[model samples]
Target: MTDQPAIELNNGVRIPQLGFGTFQVDSDETQRIVETALEAGYRHIDTAAGYYNEDGVGAALKASGLARDDVFLTTKLRNGDQGHDSALAAFEASRKALDVDVVDLYLIHWPTPTRWLAPETWRAFEKLLADGAVRAIGVSNFLPHHLGRLLETAGVTPAVNQFEIHPTHQQPAVQDASRAAGIAVEAYAPIGKGEDLSEEAVEAIAQAHDVSPAQVVIRWHLQQGRIVIPKSATPERIRSNIDVFGFELTTGQLDALTGLERANRLFPNPDEFEASQFRD
Candidate 1:
């Protein structure tokens, strides 16, 4: 219901370009923190089953009195649940935990390429879409090669491909591939885990714009037409993260940020990562 900018999905569904990410937000504190974000005008909330906070997300949404349609909610299937039937069952568990009959978006938390089950997982995603359980479907931390394989048998091209992108980790090849495949590229760690913000280029731009380094970085993402999910549990930070629509980064500044790319990746490589490691 807000005039906030959004991008149309491949299926014609409009998704708010900016979202609040609850990646490491503690489940015990998720309700209060999420309520603050909701009150700060963030309509999009992204949580994964692995985050263990979907119930809190549901509580906050219910307590806010916003209609189910007023907010856009996204949750992902965990890595342990990657097979065909298991993926479908995992989605239902997420839906129940979130207390929502329909999820705005659903994603595979990771490609888990070592398991060799991404294609099969995607098949279940297609079924969820067909059954009207999820408005849109996507994948997180997938590289171009993983997507190339999925495309071979995919009935529906992924609506979005979320990655660990920032001024430092540009991932141009993956971004370009997503664009070419008609999939929206989403920046997961858009601020570069607080490392790139201290760079000379980001600092100079922030001083010129009279905003924080994080805001300048976020603004850069918006200008480039990438969906950004910046996570913060503090009330002030949560509010500041979504208050980025007012400014624009200059072309020179944008290029300067782009030049900061050094192929610095912060998270685990999807191909080598497995869910069992986290479980134990």
Candidate 2:
């Protein structure tokens, strides 16, 4: 098998620059889609307990016959399980569901401030890392203040922050915070859920590169040094998404794409919104 390029996290863990996302992927279809991705050269798989497909992902991993070290697996701690003990138990449940002894990366799904205990949850993530149950620990949908609190309380920086970022919602502040703290930013919903890829600038860049709008967008994420998890159940789109490694985006092209930012967010901003009600 050919080697795929990897991005090194702040903590020295290596992750594939691009990964397949299983958000909203049905449990029944997870195995097949994940298998297709593995066959197509994706070694990294991103899922969450909320996605409810860890078992299927585990089955696909086994079916792929790839060694455990060869595939990078990531799962998240749901909002309901935010306290230290609750987070730890959630981690175990996730490991059981995925049938993996150790997950490559585990994340706090969201910083639901109303819970008023996100900092304590970070402590649990720290314990998970110290115990070697998770190779690295991070957070998802965290704003600058949430990250700051984690840093202040845990004294350990998150290796990565997975959040909603696309051309429409550039999130410059969060990006700056992550960069300053030496934490990598992983972009979820990198395509903006089919929202703004049709902008004239994005179209022009796609035409210049002779790639799909999705590919251009994913490449833009790569160029910005953000890990991109692009979800696709279709085999052709899956293949097209990772084909970005073969091309380069010029600085001018990247600038033009970045200039298209309109502060449009496709997902809810966890900082302003209350996720406590959504907790199960």
Candidate 3:
């Protein structure tokens, strides 16, 4: 009965467009919070090794007693593990931590171009795909130039390019590049994490639809064809975020949200970010 739609990747893998994310979610609370998300009807769950909560995510899944295939799971490699050998080892560890024989989707986490090492790391990703260790491979936080460099010798075009995208900071240039290359764009920090929830257009649209501003913003992303993952630790908000299927936005309302774009990119610029995932 869930109204979530699935988008087909270039490699023929279908992913749920609406998902629950555990970015800043704490490890101790991840299991319960994720279990709530599952019970609330979220079939897609996004976690990462860098998030330090993959074990909790796995526990939540186990506790729900849902078939492994019943949910689409996605995780990313830490920036610290960006070489062929290291990436391979990291994937194995992540798979073990999540207790999945084959991961639904695996991403490079960030271009963090040592991304001189990106091609090398990508080779490992290709190997994983070839060995059937993962269903699909993609990148996160990549820009046009980053994508360009990665594609120069890329054997498989990335199936997705996840990054920070919201009403206030839409990376149209990046989105255009990814779409043109047939790579799906997935939005992270999709609601600006409350940064722009009070924008005039968003507020107006929400008021008109009798929905929360977060829902208005999420609906905007869905209508425009971007895969969005919104996170909330609170049970009510988690359910509320996914309740977007109940309403539709008019073209004007959609455009109003579009007009709110300031091209204000958040997060580290992939071109210059050199930090790696911190190890405990």
Residue-by-residue lDDT tens digits, candidate 2, 131-211: 899999988888898888778877678999999899888899998998899889999999899776898888888898888
Candidate 1 deviant stretches above 4 angstroms? none
lDDT of each: 0.91, 0.88, 0.92
TM-score of each: 0.98, 0.96, 0.98
Q: For candidate 3, what is the lDDT?
A: 0.92
Off by over 4 Å in 3: 1-3
- Candidate 1 per-residue lDDT, tens place, 143-190, comes to 889999999989999999998999999999999999999999999989
| Candidate 3 residue pairs that clash | 114-117
Local accuracy of candidate 3 as per-residue lDDT tens digits, 1-280 = 2567999999999899999999989999999999999999999999999999999999999999899988999999999999999999999999999988989899998888654789999999999999999999999999999999999999999999999999889999999999999999999999897987999888988999999999999999999999999999999999999999989999999999999888776777877887788765
Question: Candidates 1 and 3: which is better by lDDT?
Answer: 3
lDDT of 1: 0.91
Backbone clashes counted, model 3: 1
lDDT of 2 at 117: 74
Candidate 1: lDDT of 256? 96
